[model samples]
Target: MNEEEIVQYFKCQLQEDTNVATAVAAIKTLLEFLKRDTGKDYDKCKKMMSERGELFLKRISMSRNKITTLCCPFIKDGAKILTHAYSKVVLKVLEEAAASKNFSVYVTESQPDLSGKIMAEALRNRNVPVTLILDAAVGYIMEKVDLVIVGAEGVVESGGIINKIGTNQMAVCAKAQNKPFYVVAESFKFVRLFPLNQRDVPDKFKYKADTQQQDLLEEHPWIDYTSPSLITMLFTDLGVLTPSAISDELIKLYL
Candidate 1:
C-alpha cells in the first residue's frame, strides 16, 4: 500500500484492534511518509491529519447518537448512570442528552490516566451533575447506582468486553448488585477474534518499567476484560443488544 492507503488501513485495523499505541505508531509512520513524499509541506500534512481526525470523531459521534436515540426511550428520567474512562462515545451520549436534561451521571476517576476525570469535567461543563468517585469506590457505589454504562476499547465475538482496568470489577459489582451494566461503544471497536477466556488473553498493561514509577505498573493495567454474563446490554452503532446477541451482530459487521 502507498502512504495514504497504509495509514487508512492502519486506522481500520486499529479501530478493530483498539490498540492505541499501534494507532499512534501508524499515524507517525503516515506522517513520515507525508514528509518524504511531499517535502516541506508539514503544515499540509498536519492539516490532513486534523481533518482525518475530525472525520473519525464525527463517525463515532454519529454512532453514539444512534445508540442513544435507540436506548434513551428505555431509560427513565433522572436515572443514575455509572461510567468509567473518557470515551468519545460516552461524551457524545451525554452531550446529546444534555439538552433533554434526562439523566444524572456518576463517573469513576479512572486511575493511571484518570481518563474519567476528563469525562466528568466535560459533563460538568455541559451542566450535567456528575459524581466523581475513586476506582475502589465503584462497588460501594454500585448499590445506589441504577445502571452502569461503560465504553469498550475492544469487544470479541464471544461477547467479552475489553476496557479500562477497573471496568471488570465494576461489572462484577453491578452483577452482584443486580443492576444493569451496559457497554456503550461504536461497532468499529469490536474485534472478530475470540479468546478461550480472560486468562488466555494478552495483558494490555505493559509499560517501560524503569521509565515510570514501579507502583504505577503494580497498581494498574491499561485494560481488563469483563465476562459476557455480567453485562446487561451492549449499545453499539447498530442498536442495543443483549450479550447473547453480540456474536450475531459482530458477524454482520464483517459480512
Candidate 2:
C-alpha cells in the first residue's frame, strides 16, 4: 500500500488511528521501490510488491533497532529519564535498556487523554520502574532527569518538531536545566514543511472532553511545535543527528 492507498483506507474506515503516520511512512518506501523498478510486466510487478512488503517490515525492525542502539547508551544504570506522551519507539528503547541496565522512567500524565498513564503502565508491565507525574510537574522534575526523550508527529524542515501538546514546554524545561533533550523518530517522519510557529501546524481532530470545561478547552490544541534551538539531538533511523541536519537529510531523501 502506498500513501494514497493508506490514506484512502483511513477515509473509508471513518475512524481515527494513531498508526496512520507510521503506516504512511512504511508504504512510502514501497512506493519508492516501485518507482525505481518500473515495468509493464505483471510478474515483475508482483515480484517487486513481494520484495517491497518484506523490505517494509525490515525497515520497521531496523528503525526500532536503531532507536534502541542509539538511545540506550544515554540510559545508564540508575538513570532517571523523563518522557512526554507515549511513543512506541520510545517504549521500545526503554524496554531494550531495561533488559541490560536498571533505570527509572518519569511519565507525564498527558492530560485530556492521560496517555502517559498508559505509558507508565506499559513500562511497569515490562518490569521497568516508572513514576507517574502530572503534566504541570515537568519543570519540577527536570532537575532530576538525565535525559528527555520524545516521539515526533512531524519533523519539519526548520528542524522543529510537532508532537503532543506538552512537548514544547518539556523541551523548554530541558533546555533550561541543561539536560539532553532528544527526539527519537524514524527518518520517514521528516517532512519538507517549515513551520515558523505553533500556528503553522494544521489542527488535528479535537478529542471530545467529557468535562464541563469544554468551552475553555477549545483554546488548547492537541499538538504543539518545539523549536529546533531547544532540542539537543535527534535519534533517527539514519543516525544521531543535530536538528539542523534534518533539512539536509530530507533533501537527500526526496530531491
Candidate 3:
C-alpha cells in the first residue's frame, strides 16, 4: 500500500476502537508490518499481517481479563468505588467482583461525550448499584468513597497517565481525601511519551481527526494528564505495579 493509504487505514482502525490496549496493539502491529522489506511478495505480507492482528486482539482480551480478575479482591463487600469515564476493564472488574461481593459505583458524567452514562447503564444491566454524578461533584463525594479507579489512554515513561479530561482533577481530589487512586490499564497502553504538562500532549491524541475549530481555545480538550504522584498504584496484566516501578517495566518491554 502507498504511504497515504497506510496512514488512512491506521487512522480508521484507531477511530473504530477507543480502547487504548486494542488501538495500540493494532498500531504496533501495523508499524511492525510496515517495517519489513518484503520483496515483491506483498500478498504474503498481507496474509501474515492479518494473522498477527488477530493474535494481538486475543492477547489484549486476555490481558484485560487477567487484570480484572486480579482487581476483584480490591472490591470488598459494600465498598463504594469511584470511577471516571468508561473502561471495559474497570467494568469487567466490577461485574466479576459483584458475583461475590456487593458494591456500588460512582460514575462521573464524563462530558463532551457522556460516556459515563453508558458505563452506568451497563452496570445497571449487570445489577450493580450505579450512581451518576456531575463532573464537578467528584470532590464532594470523594470522602464517601473508599478508592478512585479509572482507565487510561496512555501510561507515559514518567509513570503518569493520560486519560479522559477531568481525570487529573479526580485524581487530585482523591489524593486530598486520602483515598487510593488506582489506574487499570493493559501494558500495551504504555508508550514512550513523556509529556511534561498537559500542553505537551499531542493534539492528534487529544482531539478527533475531523475537528474543524478555527482556534484551539474555543474547544475543550478531550483528555488530560495526571501526574504519577497522585496514583496509589496501577493494576495491569503484568501484575500490580507502583508508579515508580513503571519505568522499569517499560524498559523491559521496549528496550
lDDT of 2 by residue, 134-232 (tens): 999999999999999999988889889988889999999999989989899988888878878876765443232322234534556778899999999
lDDT of 1 by residue, 1-255 (tens): 666776667766653344455676858776786667755577787799899999998987688779888666555778888999898777777777767767889999998889889999999998888999999999888888888878888887888788888889999999988998888887888887676555666643323232232454364457777889788888888777887788998788888
lDDT of 3 by residue, 1-255 (tens): 865566566666654434344655666676676668565556787789899999999999999999988888877899999999899989988888989888899999899899999999999999999999999999899989999889998999899999999999999999898999999999999999988888899776777543442355666789999999999999999999998889999999997
Residue 115 lDDT, candidate 1, scale 0-100: 89
- TM per candidate comes to 0.73, 0.77, 0.84
The global C-alpha lDDT for each of the candidates, from Candidate 1 onward, is 0.78, 0.85, 0.88
Ranking by lDDT: 3, 2, 1
True-structure lDDT of candidate 2: 0.85
**Which residues of candidate 1, in runs, are more than 4 Å off?**
1-58, 204-219
Candidate No. with top TM-score: 3
- TM-score-better candidate, 1 vs 2: 2
Ranking by TM-score: 3, 2, 1
Output the better candidate (1/2) by lDDT: 2
**Strongest candidate by lDDT:** 3
Error of 2 at 214 (Å): 13
